[model samples]
Each structure stands twice: as C-alpha cells, then as structure tokens.
Target: MFYFFFESRGNQTDPVVIWLTGGPGCGSELALFYENGPFHITSNLSLSLNDFGWDKVSNIIFVDQPTGTGFSYSSDDRDIRSDEEGVSNDLYSFLQAFFKEHPQFVKNDFFITGESYAGHYIPALASRIHQANQKNEGIHINMKGFAIGNGLTNPAIQYKAYPDYALNAKLIQQADYDMLQQKVSFCEQATKPCGNQSNAKDSCDKAYNVCGEIFNDILAIAGDINYYDIRKQCEGLMCYDFSNVETFLNQDPVKKALGVGDIEYVSCSTTVYQAMSADWMRNLADGIPSLLDLGIKVLVYAGEYDLICNWLGNWRWVDELVWSGQKQYAAAKNGSFMVDGKDFGLQKGFGPLSFLKVYNAGHLVPMDQPKPSLEMISRWTKGLPL
Candidate 1:
C-alpha cells in the first residue's frame, strides 16, 4: 500500500486522519486532486488549490489500498479477487508497516474515512484494527472513528432507495413514482417467487437494473440524451484537459510535499479494481462485525443525486441496521436544503451514528458539493453536534 500524507501545521504529535478512496479499486489521489482537497480545475481546466482543504485543520493521509492501487502494485500473478477478510488483513499489515515507518504517529488518534464502496472498506479495516488492539497488550492503536460519503453499505437498503430519491429529485413524474412503487412493493413481497435462485445476489441485480432503467428513462426525457452521455457531460464540467499529460502524470507536487512517491494510475486502473474486489468480499463476510462489536464509530454518508449509489440504496441499507438509537438526521426534499447558518444549504442530520444524503451531489459528492462535504466530515471527526 502507498500513502499520501498531509502534515498538520499545529503539531507533529497531533491526531492523524487516514482517508481511503472508494472502488475497492480507486486510489486516494482521485479524491486528493479532483474532489474536496486543495486542488480543483478552473473553468479553463487549470489546476487550482482549494483553500478549504482538510489539511488546514489536521494531518491527513490518503491511501492507495490492496497493493494494486495508484503507485502500489503486486508482482504475484495470483488472481486478486478478494472479499472483506482479504481487505482487512492487507490493511492491518499496511497499518503496522505504516506506523512503524512513522513511529511518532503510533500514539496519535487515527480516523479512517472514505466514500462509495468504502462503506465496506472502512468498517472492515476498523474491525481488523480493533482485533489487533485486543491481541496486543500495551501496544494500543488509537483508532478514533470512521466516515464515508455517498457510501454503498447495505445491499438491500441501497437497492430499495431508488424511487423515493427519483421522486424527490423530480426526475420521475408522480405517475411513474406510483407505478415504480407498486413494482418495487411486488418485488419485495414476492422475492422468493420471482426466484432465479441465485439468492439475494440475483434479486439485487434485478432490482438495481429496474432502478437503473427508471432513472435512465427519467434522464432521457430531461436531457434528451442517453444517461451515459449525460454523466459524461456532467464529468466534463469538472475535468481539466491537461496540456502536458506526461507532466501531470508525474507524481503530484502536493503529494510529493506530503512524502509519497510518483505512482502510476491516479484514477480508474484495472489493477486497482482487481485488488478491491478481492478485499471487499473477504472482509464483509467476516471482518466487519468484529469492529462494530468493538464500538468503533462508523459513519456512512450518501449524496441524493448520485444514481450510482443513490441515497435510496443507502437509506435502505441503513434501515436494516439493528442499532437502537438510529434516527433520521436529515430529510430528503428537492435536490437542495435550507440551512440556517451555512451559505451552502446542507441537509444535516445525526442518527444511528451515521450521516446520509448531501443534497445537489452525484456519485462524487465532494466534486459536486465540496464545502458541505468537508464540513460534515470535520464535524463528524471532532464528535461535534451536527
């Protein structure tokens, strides 16, 4: 694993926060360079630093995980297909090596944060850390908490949050909402009868496909184009056309300043995906429950506009959690919120120890709504009232 560290100006002994990138395959640089970090693309597509980067308040480390993301790669030709356990083990090992190298940080409070598929990654890693803490006496791992943005935590809830989010976004008409609701209800009621016999996997795939079709139809009517093209257009709004791809591909100066190497594949690389898939499945089945039982704080956030891991799905998943004090902190309305203090209206809430549904955001919440995203994260890490 390769890490990108942002030192705190306050003190070297200050708490250290580790940021994980989603995808089971994604690298942290994508978040560092493209999202809520110090760098943003100008309207002319030039790189500019965001003044509100989290680095201003605390030391942050972004990790390229599972040994195949970013600059990290594996020489073994073994199929990197992993579940949840593999992820936890690898991360546990990485943490050991990481702290050993930066021994000063061994006692600093640490937080694990991420988005998207990290809904799974963060919990699994937390579980491993907790287990290690128990196994080793007097050698404590000061794991404070974890946070996720627009996460994919529970499969069932995630699949179900579709029509509600669509209706709120005004992407689907009232009639379409009624019809889809009926279909969804029927699917839920007759889950067994509709069986292709692949268990929940087949059912979820079917449900998601139906959900995707509904959203696709809505986008088709609104944009007069295919959903893929609309997504491409949206991404184009933020992407910079670097004049010298080679120079930009070199290790980012910001990352270098933070003490990381120039790594290949900053974003969507095949190798990253292979390692992620392997790690996610392994940990989910065995690793995650261990951490939750240890009382490690886990916060999962979702962006309402993100069709990839829609708020509907996240809401559904969260609802399935058996936590006693879980409550809905924010309500879903139009693709925006009315906040009393903040200029950028944020739909804020606190319940069951997780934050969900930032408004006006797509799959990439930080890219679409950086200010609120950062604020949510800051408040969460500090254990402040949201």
Candidate 2:
C-alpha cells in the first residue's frame, strides 16, 4: 500500500513524477506531506493547504517504497533484503502493480526524484527501468530525467563540498577553513592505501571525522544551529517529529497522507533498515557505473547548508565516475536563473550536471526553500536551457 498524491489538469497529460524519499530507511511520504507538500501546519499544529505543491503542473506520486516505508509493506516472510539490484527490482514490481491498478496512467511521462541516500536509490531504479525498457517488458515508463536535492550520490564529492559550502554560508571562519583544508589533505593522503578495499577506506573515515570536527568547532564558535527553530520559521509547513513514534504513526493526517493503516511503524522500522542495509552491501561496488552504462540520466543536487550529506562528500564520490563521454554543466555565480516566470538561483554544478545550492537551506531544501526548489525542478524536468 504505497501513499501517493495524484493530480490531473484539464486535457494535458503531464508527466508522472514519482518522488522517492531518501534514507535507505526513510519514507517518501514524510518528504511529501511534512517536508515540502502542498499543506502547512497552523499555530495550533493543524494542517493547511500549500499553494506550491508539484501537483500544480504534474501528476505527483509520493511513494513509501521498497516495502516497509509508510503504508507500503510486505507479508512475504523472506528476510527483508535491500540492495541496488533488489531495490531496482522491487521498484519495478511496484510500478507494474501500480500501473495495473491505474491503467490509465500506463503511458504517462514519468520522472523519478528523491533526496539523501536516494542518491543511490534513484540511479539504481533508473538503471532498472532502462534495462526493462531494453527488453520491451513491463509498463512503458516515459522516463525522461531524474532529480535529487542535497543528495548523497558520490560520497567523495559530498565530503569535499563541506568547506566550500561552509565558506559560502559564512558558517566558518577563515582560520577554521584553513585548518579544515589541511585536515582534508591529510585524510586524502591517508585514504590512498584503502583505495581498492571493499570496505570504505580508513582515510575516508578520517576525512569524515575531520570534517565533523570542523563542524563541531564552528558550532563552538557561533553557537549550535537549531534545526527545530528553523522548522518553526516555516511554522505552517508539514514537518517530521520522531519524538513519539507511535502517536506520529497513528496521526490521522499522517495516515491519510501516507495511505497506511494502523499497526505500522513510522521513521525507523525493521523492514526499512533491512532493505537499506541490503542495498548498501549489494551496491558497494560498480553500482554507479552500472547505472551510467544504461544511458539513464542520473542527476544529483545539494543544498550548501546541509551538513549530514555535505557537498564535500558528494563531490568526492562523483569525481570517481569512470564512465567515458560524460559531460558536466556549471551554474552561474549569482546562482539566479529564470524558468517559466519564476526566478531561481544556480545552486551549484560539477561538469555537465549542476547542483543547485539553495541559500539558507539545510538538509531539507524543500522545507527551507520550497519555491526555489520547485522552480529548479520544473526547469530540470523540462530539460530547459537553465
């Protein structure tokens, strides 16, 4: 039972945007209803309508995928196992089932988008879809492009983006930046030995530790950042609260949005974790390469302010892309551009792909900068000359 949001505008057959939530264990429902949906919360904690939902121009489907997310679950006693291949396969099955249930959408244009660890999910799913298309089997998914915000695609690239993003946000002092850079250099040198190891390198571990230390030092100097406080600023917007998991799970609004019944868990369920761990192990090697080879367009976006999946780490991973003939796109300095009638910013970029950095945004760009995020996505999906 997957939770989804559907919209049909007049006679236009808009693309079906399947939005996947991040966290090899996270729920896409949370991203939709809470993080950046068309609904906001009232001062009394009641729900209100959001005017900027993606439904305005497309049929959006927010799924709690891979089973055990939100309303989606599996009764097969098989131990929950998740990997790039397994997830890709599971998603394919789900799409098959979904199309059967909603046959009218069989030929609708489809696009996949997600955040965080979905960096892995989106690419793998895209690859699977591309493969199925090759065999002329399953529903004809009019897949055009993919998108992610503040994603965890390439661990290496994500790690390196930290200091630069910090500097841009004015969150780090010059002295601190220099210190962090030296530490990064040392971590890079140390990671050389573990380059070929299946397990992540100790150097990479050290690099992450050093980066964490830099963040810690910044907090020490400027006071710790309050994520909840940031959420309060967007008071009416839907947000996640893991405090009382049971109550949160049973909440009517959440239940309705996620299309889940009672007796289900929210946030971290055993099913979700198993699926995530399985996927991690399977894709440890050759996952990204396998996807790129299929001619599927894999795009990753990052919010500069995000610390969890920092731009530095993501960048580190992307730099490892070995696929030939791949191109890169760069964003303008001011980071501002126009799409439709809306003005959005450049965010960021690597080579042919550009990562839009949402100013003042955190790990959840939609929550922090919903309008800009939406605009950026609109342009991306259209493949417009941004």
Please report the candidate that would top lDDT against the real structure.
2
Q: Summarize candidate 1's per-residue lDDT along 182-256 as a digit string, tens digits.
A: 656644543332222222444444454444454555555455422212233443422333222224546377447
Tens digits of per-residue lDDT for model 2, 1-386: 46666674423477778888876666665676556566655555566776667776577777776676666777884524445566678888888888788778778778888887777778778778877887999777777767766665544444455666666657677887787787566545544443423345344445445445544654465455542222232222123353343455577877776556564666646557644542332222235555555544555666555665665555445545665433443222435555456554444443335455455567777776777677666666666544
Give Cα distance to truth, residue 139, candidate 1, Å: 5.4
For all predictions, the C-alpha RMSD in Å is 5.6, 5.2
lDDT of each: 0.60, 0.60
The worst-scoring run of ten residues by lDDT in candidate 2 lies at 229-238
Name the TM-score of candidate 2. Answer: 0.74
| TM per prediction | 0.74, 0.74
The per-residue C-alpha lDDT of model 2 at residue 97 equals 85
